[model samples]
Target: MNRTAQPAGTPVRSVPSKFRGPFVRWPRIADATLALAMFVAVTSLEEGPGDSLVVRPVVDLPPAVLLLFAAAGAALYWRRHKPLAVLSVALAAWAPMLGSSYANVGGIVIVALYSAGRHTQDRRWGPLGVVAAVGAVTLDGLLLSLPAGEIGFGCLVMLGAWYMGRRLRLRSERAAQLRQEQAAEAQRIAAEERTHIARELHDVVAHRVSMMTVQAGAARMVAAEDPQGALEAMTAVEEAGRQALDELRHLLGVLRPKAERDGLGPQPGLTDLPRLVAQVREAGLDVSLTDDIRAPLPARVELSVYRIVQEALTNVLKHSGPHTRTEVRLGHDQCGPGISIEVLDDGQGAALQSVSGTARTTGMGGHGIVGMRERALLLGGTLDAGPRPGGGFRLTAHLPVQPVLGEPA
Candidate 1:
């Protein structure tokens, strides 16, 4: 058949890649079998002109049509891969028999037509050629004044078979195209998600790293004057930097298709309160904390509480002047249904200072405060930040402790 390569716009890969192999490359066994069956079935149905006219020799009764059919059947193997060549072979085999009362019977050319038509929309030509040749044969028989309906019936039979093959091939091609499109769309979605996450990391981690760097510089500058104090401050800065690096690695690992993240370790819970308070106290803030929770708390609830308090205190340091007063209140009860956090400070009454551009307040670019609110919402909670009714600034976070993770009751 014609192996004429389609132009660059062709869907077939240049050399039989995964993209084109299964779809375009005709299989040897299937080709050979189809060719044989079609040739035998079609040729057997033909009644040579000699048979119709009662000629003498049995071998000469009908045309030596089986030989031509055999060659056409074998040629089916390469039809899809080389359509022009296969089409030529099919025509050559069927050409001579057209003048006979009966032409080779098998509908082999229809299969080749289907294969070629799938590549181009011009599938009608296969049946057209058959019809035109049959018409010529019918006309030649008319010069002899022979029957016409029988020849017309044979031509219609071939056309019907060709139509069926074309439908089946079209369906197969559509399914393959849809599969390819779906795969491409999935890749696009994944790439977009990666880009979004990378951007979030750049905004969050970059800020933390900058803070750590600044603190480290401060510690080094004060080391000679206050050795033990400088040591503690440097250690805190080191810990902060290490945390940022770990989170950065987690985000980067997400870019890998199959790699899984260990997630930034376990998220901090309420049990971390004392340690967190101490970390800030060591940094020269005076903090008083109160807690009251008699019942066992859910993990997510405890995590939200820790984050709210952590961000609140971080803000106090960032916004409150050096001598500001800080107080934390956490409470829960059987009837409470959730937990609440109250952080109040005598300094910075909701006009939270940019504090060297470290903390982001309600309406600014900073993420620390926004992160606290996000944690609250994730736990089905609410956060209120503004000036206290009486005086100092306050941040109150209320979060559900009971998970609603079951079938509707």
Candidate 2:
């Protein structure tokens, strides 16, 4: 069916309440019409206890006329939203004739029984229906005016249908509960796996990338002035690359046994700052650095610091075409007991140019600054990248003293 309801289990009931009609009201009305049509077509069977109904004591309904009035009541039976109200009205309308043993009016009661059960997928509608049907049939037949056999048969039919609806509703409820539990469990497992992957990546990837950054810079520096010394730094970069690849491969294998099919990732980090400077220098740019980092740094913090520098310098190398001197400064300070790294380029910085003249500057960054900031935050540090005070672009990051992973809780 083209339904908006959940596909798995017990559906939320849409009862015909005082506010709105149930979705099944129209279909119910159709069912009633079909039943009445069947009865009308079989005109020969109109031999209900008409004489018996007239002399009946309780529920004064005339059996022969019950079906006609019931067909009319069926109109409102479609609005079974107010179940008790509708059923009471139908029953009360013919209460005087209920004394008849074969009260033909029971057709509407059968439909009502089904409607009452439908709300819960047929769960409820107690055995009281059984007792009421049996008692009413017996007492009306024996005491007032009904054939004992006819009363017995009518009660049996009503209870049977009610019982079937109750069973269907209960089964649907159980299935729905099972489906919900399975979904919740699947979500919980996925969340746990993501957390585990994050931990593994942070520990392995961050440490190797930090070391590669330093080594790459040193390699690029001596390549021209001292080619042999530069070769040694290059060797370190190659070694770091190999180690990172091997470790990542092992980690991935552990994380996903099937990942042997996928290849290894690239090697990159913060330690290659000097080589990065050399790479910039190679492309005809003046870059200077003042590093006085005495204390041992946290692995994640160091790696984040490295990426920020790498990305910021990349932006400078890409946009600051000429007439620029880049100054990179890394120092251990007591700014609430932390270490800070700052990279500033004295180029045609947008923020600075706006202050210097009435003219506008070139667009330098959009995603680069965002990337640097993201890296910093990932390592539990803060980053600030913008145009410098003088005439340049400035990118800075301040890291706490303690490593987040191993810090005393």
Candidate 3:
């Protein structure tokens, strides 16, 4: 994803009400106030006795002319909904005033031009309205023999008002588009996080459940032959159930809202491997571990590594027989800046053919191998799993590590 960087300390600007829609808060009242103000200003204008320009006092103007000016100002109340119509009415009224004492009705024209540019939904109509307004002002000035400079100044002022409104409208559109993009990005990230949590739950629950299943089966088989051995197997099954609930509770806590969640236990890491190995031993798997890591890794990397190893051992127990010997080795890579891991098992048990057949048919038990590979790749690592040429299963992974700031590489 690409993001545009905003300047440091720059404040975000919200879209203004004028650009949001045709009306603002209490639209009728606001329009009435503006119209009344324009009427008062135009009526208050007066030409001094010695003035060269043709202007007049409101009291001296004819009643029809006064009514025309009043009508022009009144038309502004509907400017938000009918901007072009209001502009046309104002210009028509102003045309009669030109060369007369009240030719200074351009204020009404300016307001109408702004409303037309800001409120018009059709793109073509706004520019067309502006052009028509400017042309009317120019033609009226030429017909009345008004000074060229005066006409040019009026046109420029009206165009400036229209341009200001148009610019704000475009800005409002861009801000709305940016907000929509941000919302979509947030939803996408949330979906991905949910998927990751589900995979973690699967790994945690599957291993413990598989252990309990094996232990319960063993206990049933030996109950008649060896009462003491059967009791031990049942005890192991109970312990596995308790551990599964504990880990499930720990994982589920994350799904709760922050205010409702209590403090959770720390996730298993490299230091927890001994306890993990002991649990597997009780489940009847002959397993060994060799840890040669010299330096500590980041917490996230440690958690991912622990999960990869846990899932691999779970697969071994599920597919390979309990008597098969497995070895787990962890160490820093001798040739690169990374950690290396390996899990291997000897195919000496009765279930070796079934394990190899499952590997060939189903690609290592559906979601298990895929989950392990996802964990490794997320940490900038690579994983490989398959049957060895010498008649066993082999899983290897290499995870790259970045040195922490202020730490030696």
Candidate 4:
């Protein structure tokens, strides 16, 4: 039995959860025991005023009434699995017991009506059972020449039994439907998380791999003419490859069960931006980073800032001209309590054009920009990425951050 993670405000049954386990595990045994108890109780009824609702029953009752009571009780065993048929059998036995001293089988009929309501497959079966039970009770009333009020009372009692059964059945169906809906919602959320993880992998791995490929190509080109340049390029390639591997391991660590990820290491955040910028510079691009926000930020906010800058610089490395110069700015905005990040590059505007096929950021056309924007939106922030008015590309992101109260802002 797979459990679903229900969202807040999802309904829970009033019944205690503890009993559900036992009931589900041994339903047949429980049903059989109840049937046996009803059988014994019904058989013990004797000739008395309250014994039979049949008003004027006197003479010696035939032994066949005992058999009818026994049959009705036996039918209770299969009440849940075959509700309609079980109720029919119980009613058949019940009609014959009306004029006798053994009218105690009325208990069995009530249980059967409730069972029919609770477990019947067809929705129409409940109402039909109500009619049948009422008719049976009405005919018994006529046979015993009972008054109108007594007959109506018996009919109402049977109707109530059927109504209660139907109510229980409806509630059970509703609960099952809610469980199904909850499962579907859980699956949808899991899929979104998986998509987020894939995007993170692409942003991290693609950038590093792109740099390595460029460096490897440069090494090959300069090997004969500039041995020192070639050596430096190879060094950059080695470093990029190592960083790519480390990031990959970190991303994959999340796939482990929570308990197993105890020592997997922390995620890279804004604090690690200097090392990141250094590696980007070694990739042969002219890049500089300026940081002024000394306050600690939330982990997710820090990660979003890092990826935004990283993706911008990656685009510079992949799609910009050789002379491209990039600047990264990070600081807390004085106008509001938020962190602001800007990545600008004089990269011939090709990267922006590559991403903006529609000339608007609203479309979320590319995975890189779309993913970054989604992260920002999730954190109640915003991002803008496109060509600058001058002759370059620019990416800006802002995320609201509330400093721990009574602590540094």
**TM-score versus the correct structure, for each prediction:** 0.44, 0.44, 0.48, 0.51
Error of 1 at 71 (Å): 3.2
* Over 4 Å off, model 2: 1-45, 48-72, 75-80, 120-132, 143-153, 214-235, 255-409
lDDT of 1 by residue, 1-409 (tens): 0001111222321122334453346566666667777765664454445544232333543446657767787888787677546766776676676655445433565566555544345555665655644554465456546577765665565566556656776887886675465444434444555578778788769888888888888898999999987898889898998889877776666642221244545657777899998888886677898988767777767766876787678767766645567999888734668777888777643343544321222223234444455567677777666554344566777778776585121
Residue pair clashes in candidate 4: none
What tens-digit string does per-residue lDDT give for candidate 2 at 262-360?
Answer: 654432344666876777677666778777886666666666666666666666665664446888898886647777888877775332232332111
For this target, which candidate reaches the highest TM-score against the unseen true structure? Answer: 4
Cα lDDT tens digits for candidate 4, 130-205: 8988888888788778899998998999999888878877888887786576445644655676688889989889
Tens digits of lDDT, candidate 3, 72-191: 899999998898888888888888777665766788988998888777766777777678778877877787677899889878888887888778778878776765654444344445
Model 1 CA lDDT for position 19: 46
Task: Assess each prediction's global lDDT (C-alpha) against the native.
Answer: 0.62, 0.57, 0.73, 0.72
Quick one: best lDDT, which candidate?
A: 3
Model 4 stretches with alpha carbons more than 4 Å out: 1-16, 20-25, 50-61, 217-225, 228-409
- Comparing 1 with 4 on lDDT, the higher-scoring candidate is 4
Please give the distance, in angstroms, between residue 236's alpha carbon in candidate 4 and its true position after superposition: 6.6
